[model samples]
Target: MARTLKTQVCIIGSGPSGLLLSQLLANAGIDTVVIDRKDRAHIEGRIRAGVLEQGTVTALEEAGAADRLHREGLPHDGFELAFDGDRHRIDLKALTGKTVTVYGQTEMTKDLFDKRHADGQIFFFDASDVSPRDLTTAKPRVAFTHGGESIIVECDYIAGCDGFHGVSRRAIPADVLRTFERVYPFGWLGILVERPPVSHELIYANHARGFALASMRSATRSRYYVQCDLKDDIADWSDDRFWEELATRLGADAAANLQTGPSFEKSIAPLRSFVAEPMRYGALFLAGDAAHIVPPTGAKGLNLAAADIRILSRALIAHYADGNDHHIDTYSETVLRRVWKVERFSWQLSTLMHQFPENSPFEKRMQRAEFDYLSGSETASRALAENYVGLPLD
Candidate 1:
């Protein structure tokens, strides 16, 4: 016989989004159970974007999960952009009066996991055949097999924080769900090394060869990436070749400060921008990658997910706290408004900074023009800074 457990919210993934919402709602006196297909260590081992908008930092603090983040996160008042073999600063703090924090996504996920576990929150990791049912009905629940037994989690609502490939999003009827996507021709070949970063602030560089980004996880640990063909194999990119390409793209001034070392982690991740409309279908409301995916160009993936959860956690809290349905009714519209704007920023940045194979000379000139405009016009720089720091969540 299958065992039945009950909770107010059944989070369909245990990544940062699921863990964060569960943390917030749990603090709001609501009960939740998190379910994920991957085990704890597997999830923690995944390396991801580290840049955090100020709003994301606030959400973590509100959830009581920012203690270590504040201590360890690298705060940057501005980031540099490079083109035409020259580096320029955006002065994010001067223009927008907000800064971003560079704390590894893995570290943030571990923090959420630890905080949630200490609060006696429930989690089912390494579960198989996870499925959501009765989603269109008043009472929804999840079913999955775990530890040689079938288990059902009945809940008042279901939160689909599972990613793009997860099963939660598919629960919506085909006729009701709408999706848009763009698969870039290139991917980011990234490496994690123990050497210090080439720059104190992140640098997004555009060279005739391709695009390169100099980022870091901490004072002593560096993360770097250079654009590469999607078909390129990791074996082809040895330490020497990878560093050489990175240096060439970064130009002499910035590359002079770069410290080369053997990378412990290296991988190539293809770029894609995707979104699913009407984030809610029945009792299943999608958040994070389940509803949308932005290219890593602007480092918006994790921050966007946190935005969805912040809006979502507020709506869920209102539903249980005061029997209010206003926020719940308009959640998708509210979330998507900001979603498209952020998507635009990521897409625009990707277009302006990356060397597209099919781009014409006219397109290349237009890209250079935009870079030059930002270099001279404070207005243009402020616009970029505004989007980078993140727009207000409505």
Candidate 2:
């Protein structure tokens, strides 16, 4: 049997982007129905970026889902960048008058989920074969199967908040969609453990060996990463090995306060910068990873996604509240302008911090020289801080 439902907006994907969009729209008296291929538990359990730009925090606050975030998130005024056995602090607050919140994406999604659940927002979980149809028509529809029943959701607009591998982006015509990408030569091996972080704020380190980052979920729960070969297997990286490599890369000052323990979660993620052109096709708007992706070096993944939703929610709200399509008409252009800038920062930081495979001595010297410049010049350091704190959502 087939069933049909109607809403002003149909959001595909139940991640933070989709959830935040739905929440914001609902607050404006607009109704939305959310759907995802994965169930709620699966989405909530995935480990992801924890750094939240000030803009992201504001977006959550707008959605009224920052209660727990404000209560539990760590506020970092600055983070350390290391090279040649020394750490230089980029005081984000001093340089940009802003700070980033250290709240796990997993937890953010949970907060959004809780609010959506309380609001009685409709969601289809474990939805299979989800497809967006009639995007060019006045009415856009999403068809999917859930709980062994075929369902269709008809709406004025469709939001593809689904990630890179999701179906929403695929809904666009192949020839019409152009993509840009840069796949790095190495991957990051990250581990989450039940222990205090090596530093209260995040530390990004570059060493002769590789790159390492000491980050945290909270004051008590730590997350660490080290650059590694893409071919390396998780089974090969024992806790002792990971800790030893991390210490070597972070240097003695940070290592003095190191705490090592058995990691409950471990995984390796390949580094890449990807962006899909024209975030909108007909009436379907793509936001978050559905539109772009950045490397983890700049900690822009989740924050970038939230940035997308912020613009998107505002545009959608305008369309209904005042019948303004200017924002919607230029959503892709406006968002991409910000997206490319962030991508450049993430790529630059990744190139500066990581030990490239078969990197020449000259390249290494260049990296050292650049770090020295940043360490010496407040202008250079401030530039990095400005991007780290995040650019305005203009």
Judging by lDDT against the true structure, name the best candidate.
1
Tens-digit per-residue lDDT, 25-83, candidate 1? 99999999999999999999999989999999999999999999999999999999999
Best candidate (score: TM-score):
1
- Alpha-carbon error at 351 in model 2, in Å? 0.5
Q: In terms of TM-score, how similar is model 2 to the real structure?
A: 0.99
lDDT digits (tens) for residues 1-394 of candidate 2: 6899999999999999999999999999999999999999999999999999999999899999999999999999999999957989999999888999999999999999999999999999999999999999988899999999999999999999999999999999999999999999999999999999998899999988999999999999999999999999999999999999999899998899999999999999998999998999998999999989899997998888888888988899999999999999999999999999999999999999999987799999989999999999999999999999888888
TM-scores of the candidates are 0.99, 0.99
RMSD of 1: 0.6
Q: In model 2, what is the error at residue 82, expressed in angstroms?
A: 0.6
lDDT of 1 at 19: 94
Tell me the deviation in Å of residue 176 in model 1. 0.6
Off by over 4 Å in 2: none
lDDT of the structure predicted as candidate 1: 0.95
